[model samples]
Target chain A: MTQVAQAMRDKTAVCGVGLTLGNFQDKSALALSVEAYDLALEDAGLERKDVDGLIQLSFGNDYDRFLEAVGTDVRYAYQGWSHGRFIAPMLQQAAMVVASGMAKAVAIVHGRRRRAFGQLADTEMWRQGLGPHGESPAYGAMGPVFGAAIAAQRYFHMYGGSGDDLAPIAMAFRKHAQLNPLACRTSPMTREDYLNSRWIVEPLRLFDCCQNNDGGACLIITSAERARDCKKPPVYISGMQGVHAGPQFHNLTLPGLGVAQQEVFNYRPQKEDLYAYQMAGVTQKDIDFLITYDAFSPLVLFGLERFGFCGPGEAKDFIKDGRIELGGELPINTSGGLLSEGHVVGWNLFIEAIRQLRHECGPRQVKDAEVCQYGSFLGETVIFRR
Target chain B: MEPSYKVVEEKTGRYLPVIYPEELPFWEGARKHEIILQRCNSCAKSWYPIGPACPHCFSMSFKWDRMSGRGTLHNYVVFHKPWTKWFESKVPYAVVQIQLEEGPRLTTNFLDCAVKDIKIGMPVEAVFEDITSDITLVQFRPGKK
Candidate 1:
């Protein structure tokens, strides 16, 4: 609707989905990055020579940092928004580059070994607004979590979702994580254990957030016809859209009531997204599984509502009733979301969606899964025509 | 219980104001502990983080305006997992996004009320916290007489 949609799917296809264990270890972002690059190339049954274009994701990545780490010469180089709202733009650019014959095959990549790399993202400049004329945070609200907390609170009020309801959503993913090899969380999560956890934000508990991990993931996109020769069946970039709204962003107008609600996150606010999902040409009912970006537990529930998988503020009921888990109506985060699987800044979640659609996920795969709709916690909705 | 803050910077000897080269008026108002916004003369649209021109009309016509800071609690949440150590204890604080009467919605911390007292559409007013002698940042508290 308000965000521009993509129109070229029959042309471009994602041929390979590659992800590393993505955890916070001694590995540097660059080393973890190389690991991710190797995985995608090998998985596609190709070599470095097969790639012509490269799209690198940067929230905090320096071009030099990535270029030196991976060590490649490319015909084209591109960057996407680091703050996460511009993923569709990144994919769209990669597709455009390849489809237009700018390059033959494009590798779009994102990764972070945050915990081992540097201090968590808190800086005076970020806390303050950008540009000298900008209005910095009042009382010095310098953390990204501040806006995140605001979004969580709004979802609770609009949906009648309480802390208890939010608790189980994380619990569900934590349970699913046990089956995952790369999952950072090994223990099971119980409701009592969740309630007993310390509070982080009002209504947000300690277990509510995602992990700081060391890993990287990449996708290789080529012409759909050429994709069959390289790797597995291609996951088409069926319907995609990303637009910047809001004054707070240098990319958008100031944060208006509309952009603040949609741009900071579209899926968190149910009212806007329920209407937007209609344009994707499929509804929640059509999706057999999901690969939601669960940076926080409440966020997972908020995503469910935004995707129209359930009614407004009804994600808790959908989750608590076991309707959102394996064999349920919507099997969410089969690869254990950011919380349990570890944060690859949403790339791993994308990998899992492809895995399910390809029926590669053994134990956690949704039975006969066909299509999926993903909620990028950092950006917009992605309906996969896998 | 009351809160305490330490001074970080001082507005000394008139360190250049946001004027001339650019309308550096944002600092001029922030110093007075009042939240200032910009309204475009062409389209009458309100904007924040103050800009060079009206985003709607692309007109540079703008002037300083003050608001009641009264508006609906558009959205909010509580973050407990510590992103940093500086904010470990304030876990239950209501981090809010308020749609100002002037039409600019901002991310802020809601104070002067119990956690449960926070609700959507509740009216709020600005309270500046002068963390530094030179800078005063605008936050919100429950509206009161």
Candidate 2:
């Protein structure tokens, strides 16, 4: 590990987390965000004035608007693009701020309404570099699902699997969601139901795609020393890696899947790709549980492969027979992940990691969970320790 | 020959490509039933999504070289859910990514083929569709074996 990465290890920890999922039509996005922020401050046992930093994404409101609503000031603040891929980077930024003394405590917050004013269909897909998720509107290849669908097709073609291979992922998360009261889709989903689900895009069924709903989430990061005195046990930010991008790193697809301009090949994580584990001074075996960005079921497969949890095409077989379930080896997304928990642009996944480390998750908790990871297909990661 | 999908006479609600200033030549090439891409003079490679520099060698020196209009279907998906009115009637249509002989993949629709018949590695040839007086799109169809 680099000296800089070594110094940053476990210096900052998540002191508090707040989340609100499901429809909130009566409340605006800003109001929902403010409520979550208030909950986080209370949960951290810190007054509004105690928080010296603020970070948010561009969905609900601007940073100034949020500060005005909360009536608190901070020394460090930033706003990022409102995409699930950026969530890990936002958390990493907060950790860096606290570690570097830019802020005593930083809160990364988000609130979004489904199909709100800045809808992807209305605007984002029209952006210059193709829709954020490779949405080619001209060909009616619209929505974020198109990106996952195309990647899955390529994966299946290269690795020899079909949409049926994705059933285990959907069924596994749904089982976990049944244990989570806050999960949006908690109903039992059998294999039959998965097969019967209508297709959204070929190789991706309705069940394979995450549901959109109004939600808000927040997580507070502070120096490890200060976090010790907070209301809950500090979930130390042990290691982190930023989102990888380029011709090879497509938005939703893993590197080497050859989506768009990417080169076609089987992707395997070299030493550099697993830098987060190195920074954390641990390996994949040390991870008690994992929480990944599962905007779609195929993303889980990609996430596993990207993080070296399994080989390039082996994730299909690795996720089978209750292996990723609560009682199985390397349980993933125990709080039902974005696939079932609800997508707060992936903030919920981070919150889930924090809760697992704190042992706050009752029925859905992994037994004696000590280490957790929030990894994604785009290669961004955050390794947290209890 | 008439395209299988209905092209509405009223073109108001149709979702057309937002042609960027840099991509005018590619669109103009489509109007003339040809595929044109930026090929690097130094590296001798082509790229997609219309960029200014060569992604392969970082060479700014390049030419808008005309392609053979032939490629292989590298990837595809069928959209069962339509996002717009024009696509509502065209449900279950195949959107493909064709890897050209010169090597960059392009996102486009497939013509003269059913969604089920579309396969990866299938040879496909470019076909032009003049959607409007000012806009012509580059689509693909099954090519010789």
Q: Pick the candidate with the highest TM-score.
A: 2
**Model 1, residue A155: C-alpha shift (Å):** 2.4
TM-score of chain A of 2: 0.98
The 10-residue segment with the lowest total lDDT in model 2 chain B: B1-10
Model 1 TM-score?
0.80
DockQ of each model vs. true complex: 0.31, 0.60
Give lDDT tens digits, candidate 2, residues A221-328: 999999999999999999999999877898889988889989888999999888898899989999999899898999999999999999989999999999999999
Output the TM-score of candidate 2. Answer: 0.97
Regions of model 1 farther than 4 Å from truth: A1-7, A22-24, A59-71, A115-120, A124-142, A243-283, A377-379, B1-24, B33-35, B42-47, B55-58, B68-125, B139-142
Model 1, A1-386: lDDT tens per residue? 43334345446777876788744466666666667778888888878878888887764466556766667777888876454445556766777787789988888777676644343343333322332112223333434444444455555555466677777678778878888887888688888888988776555677876757677788888887777787687776655544433443332112221335233433334445343245456666787887766777766765565555665556668787666678776788987788888877777777888777888877886888777777643336666776
Each prediction's whole-model lDDT (CA): 0.64, 0.89
How good is the docking of model 1, by CAPRI class? acceptable
lDDT of 1 by residue, B23-83 (tens): 3455556568777778877788877545577776799997777776677677665554544
Residues B1-145, candidate 2, lDDT per residue (tens digit)? Answer: 2212222335477877777777878888887888988999999998887888887899999999999989999899999987777778899898999999999888999999988888889999999999888678899999997
